[model samples]
Target: MFDKVLIANRGEIALRILRACRELGIATVAVHSTADENAMHVRLADESVCIGPPPARDSYLNIPSLLAACEITGADAVHPGYGFLAENARFAEILGEHNITFIGPSPEHIRIMGDKIEAKKTAIRLGIPVVPGSPGAVRSGDEAARIAEEIGFPVLIKAAAGGGGRGMKVARTPADLAEALTTAQTEAKAAFGDDAVYLERYLAKPRHIEVQILGDGQGNAVHLGERDCSLQRRHQKLWEEALSPALNADQRHAIGTRVATAIADLGYSGAGTIEFLYENGEFFFIEMNTRLQVEHPVTESITGIDIVQEQIRIAAGAKLSFTQDDIVFSGHAIECRINAENPLTFTPSPGHIDSVHVPGGLGVRVDSGIYAGYTVPPYYDSLIAKLIVMGKSRNECLMRLRRALGEYVIEGVETTIPLFIDLLKDDDIIDGNYDIHWLENYLERRRQ
Candidate 1:
């Protein structure tokens, strides 16, 4: 086991990793931007290093700063707890060159899965089901239009190398496709430095489901089941629940196994998530998240697994403790992503947090990077905390989550709390009858 691991992230995820390291008897070093000095992750870590100023490019996303921090702190490994450089293939290679473990998959895996076109090609080659659309990246709007005509109208134009909603546009008509293509290309170029964009048949309504997998380096892998993340805004996942109340066991096992086997055969290791779109009993591969997910706690709550700890062990060349047979899923788990944004306008709200009171209970877990008196800076992601609750049934879990949300009091900044509170009361959410567009329409309906 590594004596020390540097967390190349901030906020609740940083704290989450630090806490896991502590439990594993490993020392931790936290790298934060100047704006995050008062962050809870910094306070709880064994040691802290300031990478740079607030802008993510200079701090959290600064490759050199992160590597320097690792070297300066003598960290044996780096745990990129999602986002930033988590899926950057070059970063993984740099860590390998420095003889430091990158607690994720191999650089090659990240590269193959990082690019949308490449990911789709790989999936198709592996006989994995994929949504019908362009065969590869479209160089121009004309190309995108041609592909859209072939696939049918109402297609989605997406960046070939980005995720989390960036560089995605839906063209409902040929006229819209032309403009959307240009905008998508520009956005993709700015965000990923790659102007290449792709097209896909836009599903009118689908359930966003993802499978969790743990792969040991010895060519062994197991699926931890699925997560229902259909509750989203624009493309950001606002909430996630385990066991995908939408998919039956047969469908879950089939899709999960296929995704795991395909990726595992490609030499994937550590913890990763394979995201899929479920529509009309058919599952389609979308993309794979190559690092720890923000909603990992929900997976943990149901399986009694410490994902961060497992990531550490896996990085240290340890074999998986449990196999597919040993794994057991118990109860239901739900996660609400509490962002620093207006519940109504859905705009980012960043400022000082005057006060904070976290919820606690038997199955309630709050992963946060902010505390009372800590400022929610406007420089980064607006996410403040992830409220996770577990129970024997989805109904009980909903009650727990509702109570937990009520108990959480974050002052001095607008939040999506009211949004979740309202969502909880919706019959569609309560009945588990929702799609990716459900929240969008629901919010619209709420306004009118």
Candidate 2:
């Protein structure tokens, strides 16, 4: 195990990583920007270092400052908590050059999976199902039109290196193709600094499903079932639940086995998610996240696994602690990403948190970094906490989640709590009958 680990990000995830390290008997070093000086993680860590100013580029994303912090603190490992440098292959390689361990997958795998075009190709080679579309990035509008025609109408144009829906466009017909391609490429260049874009056949009513897997980089891996993250707006997941409400036992087992086999064969290390779009009866691969996900708590709640600790162990050269046969999935678990945003307008709400009252119970958990007097800086992501609830069944889980949501309280800033409250009242949400586009449509209806 690492003697000391540096948490390379902020917010709830940083706090999450720190607690895991403390439980593992490892000392922790918290790196933060000036704006997060009063953050909860900084207070809990054994030691804290202010890397830079408020801007992410000068702070969390500043590689030099992070390296300096690690060097000064004598930290042997870095646990990037799912953003900033988490999946940056170059950052991982640089840490290696400095003899500092990055508690994530191999840089090569990160690079491959980070590129949407290459990720699709890799998934196909691994026997994973992918959507039918262009073989590679289209070079021009003409090439894009040809591929779209072959793939049929309603093709999706996506950035080869995009995420969070920044560089994605849908073309339902030939007339929309040119504009969609140009827009996707332009947005891709702005967001990822890569103009490369690829095509995929868009599924109209697919449910977002992802499988969580852990590997030892030594030919051993296990899948912890699937998460239904279909509820979204602007491609950002708002709610996630384990043992997807959409799949049965056989489907779960089959997909889990397939994902585990592929990860093991590839010698992947640490925690990763194989995301897919499921419609009708087939699953089409989308992309792979090479680090921990925000909704990992739901999977942990059902499987009784400590994903963060396991990531540390894997990075320290340990094999997987348990085999696939030893794994067992228990009750259903759901996680609602409580963001600091207005429920109605969906606009960012960053300000002082005068008080906080997180819910607690037998199967309820809240992972947050906010405190009574801490101010939620506008310089970072709006997510302030994660409310995860578990129950013997999905219905029970939803019931518990509803109660928990009512109990959660945060003052001095508007939150999306009201949005979740409204969602729980919908028949589609109650019946688990929502798809990827359901939330957007629901929100539109609410506005009207």
Candidate 3:
């Protein structure tokens, strides 16, 4: 076990990793930007270091400063909590060269899975079904048009290195393919510094389901069920739930086992998620997140597994604590990503939090870094907290989530709480009859 671990991120996830380290008798070092000098995680960590200015390029995303902090703190391992280098293969390789353990998967796996084209190829090789499209990246608009025609139109042009819906465009007909391909390539070049883009047959009204897997890097892995992350806006997940209301027992088991086995076969270690788009009782692989996901709490709630701790243990050469048979998933769990934004307009709300009250009860958990006086900086993501609730059934979980959202309060700044409150009452959300496009359509209807 590592004596000290440096957390290479901020916000609630930083605190989440800190708490896990404390429980495991591992000291934690928190690295923060100037804007987050007094962040909750920094205050709670065993030690803290200022990395750089508020800008992410000079701070959270700066690799040299992170390495310097680790050197100064004598951190034997680094835990990148979600974003900002968590999936960077070069970062993992750098840590390895420095003889410091990266509490995640190998750099090879990260490199392979980080690129959409290679990930899809790996999925196909592992017998995981993928959306039909071009065999590889199309070189020009003419080639893209040819691929779209062969795939029967309605194809999605996606960045090979994209995420969070940045370099993606959909073309429903041949006329739209050329422009869509060009725009996707431009966006991909700007966003990821890579002009490579691939095409895929877009599925309408698909439910986004992802299976969580933990591996020991030696061909041992286990799946902890799946999460329904269909509630999205602008390709960002807004709400997530475990024990997906969409899948039956047989479907869940089959998909879960297949993902676990494939990842283990590839010698993947630590925490990873295999995401799929499900429609008409078929699952098509979209991508794989090679690090801990933002919506991990819902999975933890149902499985009672400390994913962060497992990541650390795996990095320390520990075998998986349990096998597939030993794992038992419990009741339904739901997580609402509370963002500091206008509930209706969805604009970033960055300011001081005057007063706050987090609800607590059986099976309700609030993971946040904001306090009464914390100022939400506009330089980063708007997510402020995660409200996770679990219950014996999906109905009970929804009820608990509604009550919990009502009880959650944050003054001096607008939050997505109102949005969730309204959503809880909607027939579609309550009945779990929503898809990846459902929330956006609902919001659009309200705007009209």
Number of the top lDDT candidate: 2
Ranking by lDDT: 2, 3, 1
lDDT of 3 by residue, 1-448 (tens): 9999999999999999999999999999999999999899999999999999999999999999999999999999999989999999999999999999999999999999999999999999998989998888887888888788888879999999979998899999888888888888999999999989999999988999999999998889999999999999999999999999999999999999899889888888989999999999999999999999999999999989999999999999999998999888899999999999998799999999999999999999999999998999999999999999999999999999989988999999999999999998899998999999999999998899
TM-score of each: 0.97, 0.99, 0.99
Range of the 10 consecutive residues with the lowest summed lDDT in candidate 1: 259-268
lDDT per residue for candidate 1 within 174-282, as digits (tens), equals 9898889889989999988988988999999999999898898688888888999998878889999998898777887788778778766776789998888989998
Candidate 1's error at 353, in angstroms?
2.0
lDDT of each: 0.89, 0.94, 0.94
lDDT score, candidate 3, position 4: 99
**Clash pairs, model 1 backbone:** none
Report the Cα lDDT for residue 425, model 1.
85
The TM-score obtained by model 3 is: 0.99
- Count of clashes, each model: 0, 0, 0
Residue pair clashes in candidate 2: none
Q: Give the local distance difference test score of model 1.
A: 0.89
